[model samples]
Target: MADAADGARTPAARLRALLAAAPADGPVLAPGAYDALSARLVADAGFSCVYMTGFGTTASLIGQPDIGLLGAAEMADNARRIAAVIGDVPLIADADTGYGNALNVARTVDTYERAGVAGIQLEDQVTPKRCGHMGGKEVISTAEMAGKIRAACEARRDPDTVIIARTDAVATDGVDEALDRARAYRDAGADVLFVEAPTGEADIEKIAGALAGGTPLLFNWAEGGRTPPLTLPRLRELGFSLVLYPIGTLLAATAGVRSLLETLRRDGTPAAALGSPQQMTLPGFDEFTELVGLSAIREREARYS
Candidate 1:
């Protein structure tokens, strides 16, 4: 296993470097990974960073929605495993409302930092928080959310570990209120500010205009969600530092699986699906084994033998 001490940059350090080197006029696109294999795939595809989506993780792990079904420990363990596999590739994990209050936020930060995440995102949703893009979302008071951000900042062991504050106030209060909450979060020591589920391009531009110069802002390019989808160039033009595609891969995988299952049911075989140009080719046995580190395990076994 590759350890951080094996002449490798720590995950936090790598993340910090990526953030520092990010193009001032463009955004760093970090795609979400639900598991260790997905994280490795993200790194292999040459992404500078990876985002751990709570929605994807919950769906992949337990076939559940992103409605606060997973607790802090479960989320942290998933993050730890993903970080271990992706070694040195900075992981920005979703730490959803810190699972409770300000003290809970502190513990959540501590857990994520210890789990090797480069950044942890905390939202301002109420306890048992639903997805930001979902309806009927309500956010806590701005002062309370700001206090949680402060707690998260204070609990970080590594100064480079980013504290991202996400405000879901747009759904409840309005864009103006959301922007206000973001400013408060930034004042409370949030390293990155995210205004969740901004409905239109105008609001997106407003978020960047208001928050971009002072603090690094995050844009969510949520597919099939409330937010209007914008190109990377456009988002960068708006001055977003980090852009997260939280469920693109997950949704793609879901579609692929559904297609394969439908084809199998119709033909009673995978031959047609495998041969289709639109379908992804299945990995060979050797390639799949190597992907999971069979070669490294074999080398260790040989040394023992």
Candidate 2:
């Protein structure tokens, strides 16, 4: 499961496997990882795939929200690092609005394909991203998003590289419009349908059935997003193949860092309560001997020979 050398195995291959395995299973979990270390941790924890979260990356890197602060270059570098440490785990990325118009989407598809993402979820929210299930959401015309979808489909080098179309129309237009957009995107060659923020179970069931067993489905489990919370089993029963728990890691890490800082400030000494002497856990010390063990072994062999 950890090998990255098999020519026949690709991120797209892993994604297809998940699509095939979705039926009659718990919702496929794609926890968001902000950086290389977290990606490795997630892969090692036995997740089938990892999500390169935009919100986490932005806030952790520059202390900002998903308000479209990180540009294409930053996102690309982050994705490259994430792909590297996670080995060959399928990465489902957040390509927020393809980072621009249709032409930009075309380039994005090519770039992300080269970056080795198994699939990408493209939203219709006009740039300066608003949460998919949140208030004050703006959406592009169905025709425009449809055009972008077509561009992405055509730009990809691998046919199996999934193109997921996500719409914020549910809040802006209504369930009917969102469903309409999903149908149109499906017709435009999208592999998966993401009618984001369906308000209730009824609409969720409606969307699940609307695909007519054609393409796969995706959902976001944003804690405060417009969509009502549901259990993993419930989401699976509703026929969703992929679920993204984005921002959870960043939120947890933010909370922990703040707590540690508060403890240090209040006690005037974090060393006594948290880490070793001076409460800094050796503060910035990294033990490298274990990391270089293989290098040491190689050097020893050369010396001996």
Candidate 3:
């Protein structure tokens, strides 16, 4: 894993510092990025952190849905690329079901930590898990999930590398069952608790009320997902310490690409849409190059020459 600019503090240490002094007004907002370019965009936009969304990764990498299609190696390689580009910005990655049983989870944790992710979210969903918002999801037993959490905790070399425990019990069982599962995960040594896909605002509040005030809580503000969206202040008041806007970037990029393709096909030119308000919002050619660190590359080349 690459060190921060100081060359001493690792990305995990920076994330731990952020958590230690996190504000009460709002949870850390981690926007999802599918590739190194999108990860750079998130960091350049001044966000302190970025998230590697499994949904976006599966979509971008294989043009498939997030159906447990990709394995540990694929996810870790993508994490490495994003981590390399983002420099000091902490990355929180989704390690789906830890790719297998308790032993697999341990290896997944070690691999992701080495890949430079500051946090790894492991869910209780059964193997070959689909998106939390999607139907036909199932969760493993509480004991089994707790065992996974312990294995993850034991496997990480950096104690600051957070192990986030997510429960898909709300979909399979009920909110109460989800809360119970979350509590068990916490007891099993999870650094953060994530109860995935609460269908209503009431359920959201119920989750925070039940599991908050002890371990740090995570909220998934996944765009167009099953969970109802809430304002940051409301989530803060509900006691969430981290909020993930997973899939928003992917959704917006998809819409933008589709619109451009339609314009090109119809008008035989993209000039009409190029200067439109929507396109105007995008960065220009030179600005994008600078954003991607062309200046830094040029400086290095000049030094060598």
By TM-score, highest first, what's the ranking? Answer: 3, 1, 2
- Tell me the tens digit of each residue's lDDT in model 3 across 1-305: 12232343777777766665454435778999999989988998988789999999999999999999999999999999999999888999999999999999999999998899999999999889999999999989999999999999999999889889999999999999999999999999998899999999999988888886768889999899898889988887888888999999999899999998998999998777678655674567787788888999999999999
Could you give the candidate ranking by lDDT, starting with the highest?
Answer: 3, 1, 2
On TM-score, the stronger of 2 and 3 is 3
The root-mean-square deviation over C-alpha atoms between each candidate and the true structure, in angstroms, is 3.5, 4.0, 3.1
Candidate 2 positional error at 290, Å: 6.7
- Which residue pairs does candidate 2 place in steric collision? 133-226, 271-278, 271-279
TM-score of each: 0.93, 0.86, 0.94
Task: For candidate 2, write residues 6-48 as lDDT tens digits.
Answer: 3437778777767766774555788888887677768878888
- Write down the lDDT that model 2 would get: 0.80
The worst-scoring run of ten residues by lDDT in candidate 1 lies at 1-10
Question: Which portions of model 1 show Cα errors greater than 4 Å?
Answer: 1-8, 276-280
Clashing pairs in 1: none
State, as a TM-score between 0 and 1, how close model 1 is to the true structure. Answer: 0.93
Candidate 1 lDDT: 0.86
TM-score of 3: 0.94
> Model 2 off-target regions past 4 Å?
1-8, 272-305
